[model samples]
Target: MATFLRENASELGVRYVIWQGRIWSRGAGDQGGWGRPYDGGGVYDPSDATGGHYDHVHVSVRR
Candidate 1:
Protein backbone atom coordinates (compact mmCIF):
# COMPACT_ATOMS: atom_id res chain seq x y z
CA MET A 1 0.00 0.00 0.00
CA ALA A 2 2.78 2.36 0.84
CA THR A 3 4.47 1.71 -2.46
CA PHE A 4 1.34 2.42 -4.41
CA LEU A 5 0.69 5.57 -2.45
CA ARG A 6 4.20 6.80 -2.99
CA GLU A 7 4.14 6.06 -6.70
CA ASN A 8 0.94 8.01 -7.20
CA ALA A 9 1.50 10.59 -4.53
CA SER A 10 1.97 13.42 -7.03
CA GLU A 11 -1.14 12.84 -9.13
CA LEU A 12 -3.22 11.68 -6.18
CA GLY A 13 -2.22 14.59 -4.02
CA VAL A 14 -1.94 12.12 -1.19
CA ARG A 15 -0.84 13.50 2.13
CA TYR A 16 -1.49 10.68 4.55
CA VAL A 17 -2.14 6.98 4.27
CA ILE A 18 -3.40 4.84 7.13
CA TRP A 19 -3.37 1.04 7.13
CA GLN A 20 -5.16 -0.75 9.98
CA GLY A 21 -7.04 -3.87 10.91
CA ARG A 22 -10.63 -4.54 11.83
CA ILE A 23 -12.37 -6.18 14.78
CA TRP A 24 -12.99 -9.90 14.76
CA SER A 25 -15.25 -10.16 17.80
CA ARG A 26 -18.41 -8.30 18.67
CA GLY A 27 -17.24 -7.80 22.21
CA ALA A 28 -14.18 -5.97 20.96
CA GLY A 29 -14.37 -2.23 21.33
CA ASP A 30 -11.96 0.46 20.33
CA GLN A 31 -8.57 -0.50 21.64
CA GLY A 32 -7.64 3.23 21.51
CA GLY A 33 -3.97 2.40 21.73
CA TRP A 34 -3.59 1.53 18.02
CA GLY A 35 -6.02 4.07 16.61
CA ARG A 36 -8.18 1.25 15.31
CA PRO A 37 -11.89 1.02 15.95
CA TYR A 38 -13.21 -2.27 17.26
CA ASP A 39 -16.24 -2.13 15.02
CA GLY A 40 -14.13 -1.62 11.90
CA GLY A 41 -16.44 1.21 10.92
CA GLY A 42 -16.11 4.82 12.05
CA VAL A 43 -14.69 6.55 15.06
CA TYR A 44 -15.50 4.54 18.16
CA ASP A 45 -17.38 5.91 21.08
CA PRO A 46 -16.17 4.85 24.49
CA SER A 47 -19.51 5.75 26.03
CA ASP A 48 -21.29 3.08 23.99
CA ALA A 49 -19.36 0.27 25.61
CA THR A 50 -21.26 -2.15 23.38
CA GLY A 51 -18.12 -3.15 21.53
CA GLY A 52 -17.77 -3.65 17.80
CA HIS A 53 -19.70 -5.90 15.41
CA TYR A 54 -17.32 -6.22 12.47
CA ASP A 55 -13.73 -6.81 11.44
CA HIS A 56 -11.47 -5.67 8.56
CA VAL A 57 -8.54 -3.53 7.65
CA HIS A 58 -9.09 0.20 7.35
CA VAL A 59 -7.23 1.98 4.56
CA SER A 60 -7.51 5.73 4.45
CA VAL A 61 -5.85 8.08 1.96
CA ARG A 62 -5.84 11.79 2.55
CA ARG A 63 -5.09 14.39 -0.02
Candidate 2:
Protein backbone atom coordinates (compact mmCIF):
# COMPACT_ATOMS: atom_id res chain seq x y z
CA MET A 1 0.00 0.00 0.00
CA ALA A 2 2.82 2.39 0.80
CA THR A 3 4.51 1.61 -2.48
CA PHE A 4 1.29 2.21 -4.41
CA LEU A 5 0.70 5.53 -2.68
CA ARG A 6 4.27 6.64 -3.22
CA GLU A 7 4.09 5.74 -6.90
CA ASN A 8 0.97 7.87 -7.45
CA ALA A 9 1.57 10.51 -4.78
CA SER A 10 1.53 13.42 -7.21
CA GLU A 11 -1.79 12.42 -8.74
CA LEU A 12 -3.32 11.59 -5.37
CA GLY A 13 -2.07 14.68 -3.54
CA VAL A 14 -0.47 12.60 -0.86
CA ARG A 15 1.37 14.68 1.68
CA TYR A 16 2.68 11.88 3.82
CA VAL A 17 2.09 8.42 5.22
CA ILE A 18 2.73 6.77 8.58
CA TRP A 19 2.93 3.03 8.92
CA GLN A 20 4.86 0.47 10.90
CA GLY A 21 6.72 3.18 12.81
CA ARG A 22 8.06 4.79 9.65
CA ILE A 23 7.04 7.93 7.77
CA TRP A 24 7.19 9.00 4.14
CA SER A 25 6.58 12.55 3.02
CA ARG A 26 6.32 14.06 -0.43
CA GLY A 27 8.24 17.14 0.67
CA ALA A 28 11.16 14.92 1.68
CA GLY A 29 11.19 13.31 -1.81
CA ASP A 30 11.73 9.70 -2.82
CA GLN A 31 15.26 9.31 -1.51
CA GLY A 32 14.04 9.97 1.99
CA GLY A 33 10.68 8.31 1.70
CA TRP A 34 9.96 6.04 4.66
CA GLY A 35 13.55 6.44 5.79
CA ARG A 36 12.37 8.48 8.74
CA PRO A 37 10.85 6.70 11.65
CA TYR A 38 7.88 8.01 13.56
CA ASP A 39 7.88 7.84 17.32
CA GLY A 40 4.40 8.05 18.81
CA GLY A 41 5.35 10.79 21.24
CA GLY A 42 2.29 11.90 23.23
CA VAL A 43 -0.12 11.15 20.43
CA TYR A 44 0.23 7.37 20.36
CA ASP A 45 1.00 5.14 23.25
CA PRO A 46 4.00 3.04 22.42
CA SER A 47 2.76 0.35 24.76
CA ASP A 48 -0.41 -0.13 22.76
CA ALA A 49 -0.63 -2.49 19.83
CA THR A 50 -1.57 0.20 17.34
CA GLY A 51 0.40 3.01 18.95
CA GLY A 52 3.32 2.64 16.59
CA HIS A 53 0.88 2.03 13.75
CA TYR A 54 2.06 -1.54 13.53
CA ASP A 55 -1.43 -2.76 12.71
CA HIS A 56 -2.55 -0.07 10.27
CA VAL A 57 -1.52 2.58 7.82
CA HIS A 58 -2.11 6.31 8.23
CA VAL A 59 -2.27 8.35 5.06
CA SER A 60 -2.16 12.13 5.07
CA VAL A 61 -3.53 13.85 1.99
CA ARG A 62 -3.17 17.40 0.76
CA ARG A 63 -6.19 19.56 0.17
Candidate 3:
Protein backbone atom coordinates (compact mmCIF):
# COMPACT_ATOMS: atom_id res chain seq x y z
CA MET A 1 0.00 0.00 0.00
CA ALA A 2 2.77 2.42 0.93
CA THR A 3 4.64 1.60 -2.23
CA PHE A 4 1.57 2.19 -4.40
CA LEU A 5 0.78 5.40 -2.60
CA ARG A 6 4.32 6.70 -2.92
CA GLU A 7 4.39 5.82 -6.56
CA ASN A 8 1.21 7.75 -7.27
CA ALA A 9 1.43 10.45 -4.67
CA SER A 10 1.64 13.20 -7.27
CA GLU A 11 -1.55 12.16 -9.03
CA LEU A 12 -3.31 11.56 -5.74
CA GLY A 13 -2.21 14.89 -4.26
CA VAL A 14 -0.87 13.17 -1.23
CA ARG A 15 1.14 15.38 1.08
CA TYR A 16 2.17 12.65 3.44
CA VAL A 17 1.41 9.17 4.73
CA ILE A 18 1.83 7.75 8.22
CA TRP A 19 1.86 4.11 9.16
CA GLN A 20 3.74 1.76 11.40
CA GLY A 21 5.26 4.64 13.35
CA ARG A 22 6.91 6.07 10.26
CA ILE A 23 6.04 8.77 7.78
CA TRP A 24 6.66 9.57 4.18
CA SER A 25 6.28 13.16 3.06
CA ARG A 26 6.30 14.33 -0.51
CA GLY A 27 8.27 17.47 0.29
CA ALA A 28 10.94 15.47 2.05
CA GLY A 29 12.10 13.90 -1.19
CA ASP A 30 11.95 10.23 -2.07
CA GLN A 31 15.41 9.59 -0.72
CA GLY A 32 14.19 10.35 2.77
CA GLY A 33 12.15 7.18 2.43
CA TRP A 34 9.62 6.07 5.04
CA GLY A 35 12.29 5.69 7.69
CA ARG A 36 11.40 8.99 9.33
CA PRO A 37 9.64 8.27 12.57
CA TYR A 38 6.25 9.84 13.00
CA ASP A 39 5.59 11.98 16.06
CA GLY A 40 1.90 11.02 16.03
CA GLY A 41 0.82 14.63 15.59
CA GLY A 42 1.77 15.26 19.21
CA VAL A 43 -1.43 13.56 20.31
CA TYR A 44 -0.14 10.07 20.76
CA ASP A 45 -0.53 8.03 23.90
CA PRO A 46 2.28 6.06 25.44
CA SER A 47 0.31 2.85 25.11
CA ASP A 48 -0.63 3.48 21.51
CA ALA A 49 1.19 1.53 18.89
CA THR A 50 2.72 2.89 15.70
CA GLY A 51 1.92 6.45 16.67
CA GLY A 52 -1.77 5.66 16.76
CA HIS A 53 -1.74 4.55 13.17
CA TYR A 54 -0.66 1.00 13.77
CA ASP A 55 -3.94 -0.52 12.66
CA HIS A 56 -4.58 1.64 9.62
CA VAL A 57 -2.98 4.03 7.23
CA HIS A 58 -3.13 7.78 7.65
CA VAL A 59 -3.00 9.88 4.53
CA SER A 60 -2.77 13.63 4.30
CA VAL A 61 -3.64 15.30 1.03
CA ARG A 62 -2.89 18.72 -0.32
CA ARG A 63 -5.66 21.18 -0.34
**Which RMSD values do the candidates have, in order?**
10.2, 2.6, 2.7
- Give the residue spans of candidate 2 off by over 4 A: 29-33
lDDT over C-alpha atoms for residue 7 of model 1: 52
Q: Model 1 over residues 1-63: C-alpha lDDT tens digits? A: 544654575566655333343222222333564334344245764234332322323234454
- For lDDT, candidate 1 versus 3, the one ahead is 3
Q: Which prediction has the highest lDDT against the true structure? A: 2
Clashing pairs in 3: none
Model 3, 1-57: lDDT tens digits are 876787799999988887777778886854455647776676885238745577778
Clashes of 2: 0
lDDT of 2 by residue, 1-63 (tens): 977887798999998877777778876744454637677767897446698777887888989
Where model 3 places Cα greater than 4 Å from the true spot, the runs are: 29-33
C-alpha lDDT of candidate 2 relative to the true structure: 0.76
lDDT agreement with native, every candidate: 0.40, 0.76, 0.74
Total clashing residue pairs per candidate? 1, 0, 0
Would you list the rank order by TM-score, best first? 2, 3, 1
